[model samples]
Target: MTTRRTFMKGLAGGLAFCSCGMLDAASAQHHAPRRLPVMVSGKRIRTVDVHAHCLFHESLELMGDAVARILPPTKGQQEHFIVVENRLRSMDAMGIDMQVLSINPYWYGKDRDLSAKIVQINNEKLAELCASHPDRFAAFASLSLHHPDLAVQELEDAIKKKGLKGAAIGANVGGVDFANPKFHPVLAKAEELGATLFIHPYRLGELASRFKGNGWLANVVGNPLDTTIALQKLIFEGVLDKFPKLKVLSAHGGGYLPSYAPRSDHACFVSPQNCDPTIQLKKKPTEYLNQLYFDSLVFTPEALRHLVAQVGASQIMLGTDQPIPWEEHPVDHVFATESLNDSQKAAILGKNAAHLLDLKFS
Candidate 1:
């Protein structure tokens, strides 16, 4: 080298040129990182659909005759079994990373023994599926709330032995409200065990009869109404107050409670005796809404926006209610909403769910 500075500068210039050339080569070979196909923000985000249903082959086999008996002989509801496979395919097509499956609560009838058998069979298959497709499926175990002791035993076996993520219970089980004292043991067990209880609505009962005519009216309108009533019963009746550790998730965006919680508080203020004395909620009815989580299956962007605002983005998890006639595209719905930023959307779509399920993204 003639001089150190001159040689160093020359070498630096050559290295810079080489680096630029490499950058150009890399740019030519690769496109800018594509955003995840569906996200609240146009960034690469993985999504988890929390409120998906998966019909086990055995469940379908058990219910096949029942399904046929219920359906119109002309149209044939037997074909509905395809809905399960179709839902799984749709999740794959939409880039949904994981689906937390639960059998719809309607199948849990008034028969305690039959319900227990059904739950055991369904959960066994669900556990098997999770084992086989460790990457794709997780599940919430269904319990036979018709028998509280049996349910508690099942909960222990499911969570401690079978390794289920959580348990799914209906808004009302065998005509007993979730807030009823009869269910206290189950709730206590769930809370003590740190289990997530996903509450869904059953199709028939006194509440369903209120809708009249076809049960579809009850399912469409009364289902969400039942959810609201059940949750309020839990809150006002002191179930939540007593068991703060219980992780209760209300389906269909927590029904109408998020929107009309003020009425409940006002009623309580007017007549404290009407509400359960055991509850010691320090805030308004709406305030406790944050304690529960909601799924993003509200159907419209406006409804979702309101729900997100009420519950905040972190408490909102993605739910599709897959394999059901009323299922919606929660991933696309979240992505299409312009109200939320990248981070908020990411939390709702998958991050929140991942945290809840204690999953690791590879």
Candidate 2:
């Protein structure tokens, strides 16, 4: 039986031939090549990016002088000014069909009320953008986890009322780790609603002072480490067991979990006393890693290949972490990866995301 990957490749080839109408000429060409084959399934596979960020002008206005106060806008920091229109242009250039717009979690500070307001404004704008350009955009609602009740209210409003596909949550909320019982109600609500939760990392303010001299070390290294820690907490604390229906999509390819699963499993087996009693997992901690979704932002082909091997292509989707310094050309990056066949590449580029987001593209 042909796998999903092979079937997609065959479909892509058929669509390409029907559209081009020069299969014989293409096959006969020896010296120079004509148009290359489309890399994904369907005639126009909606490249639904599960992870793309946008900051509206209103949000910037809300920030008011705070933006300049935090970090002066420089050449490389142009994405800081990326509004909805600017993000749309970037998506067009990158061949992304619909972007699942989210706001970076940096704006959430300790003040619960202020964070709720910020999330409200950002999520409303995101909803409006998706409504206005239904073909070009989808959205993931942002929540103020600092205020769980308000966050849950906003989530219900966004999904049931605004028709948002999912939500974007930070690894931690005002220094409170996500696995803490305080956040269980929020997780349960997400599971009940059947909404995906995209987990992004924010710079741990408490840890930033420790890396005073290293520029971006707190963001680059600290952020992924924070993700690793938060995920492990959720697993070992049995949060996953409580809400097995929760659909989580982790950024940066789930940080170090895939690489460090063996050690975690060994520790769990060898020292049950050290492991949390709440964790009643039937398999190793790493086995549950496949239950979550991941983005194709691992940077290198080898890394992407390893991720596919570990989690399989169906759980992988395209993500650019848009308007961020770490963002790469997602389409080009996947195309260059020699390890994936045409069909697997197509799935990562858009098919998986389209299915996850419940997007309808003709």
Please report the TM-score between candidate 1 and the true structure. Answer: 0.80
Candidate 1 lDDT tens digits, 64-124:
3453333222221222233435545556654577888887654555476676777889789
Please give, for residues 86-194, the per-residue lDDT of candidate 2 as tens digits.
6666676566777788776756664776666677788888878788889878889988777788778888888999989889888887778888998888898999999
List residue ranges in candidate 2 displaced over 4 A: 1-38, 41-43, 60-65, 69-76, 80-85, 110-112
In terms of TM-score, how similar is model 2 to the real structure?
A: 0.83
Instruction: Write down the lDDT of every candidate, Cα atoms only.
Output: 0.71, 0.72
Candidate 2: the clashing residue pairs are none
Worst 10 residues of 2 by lDDT: 15-24
RMSD of each: 18.0, 11.7
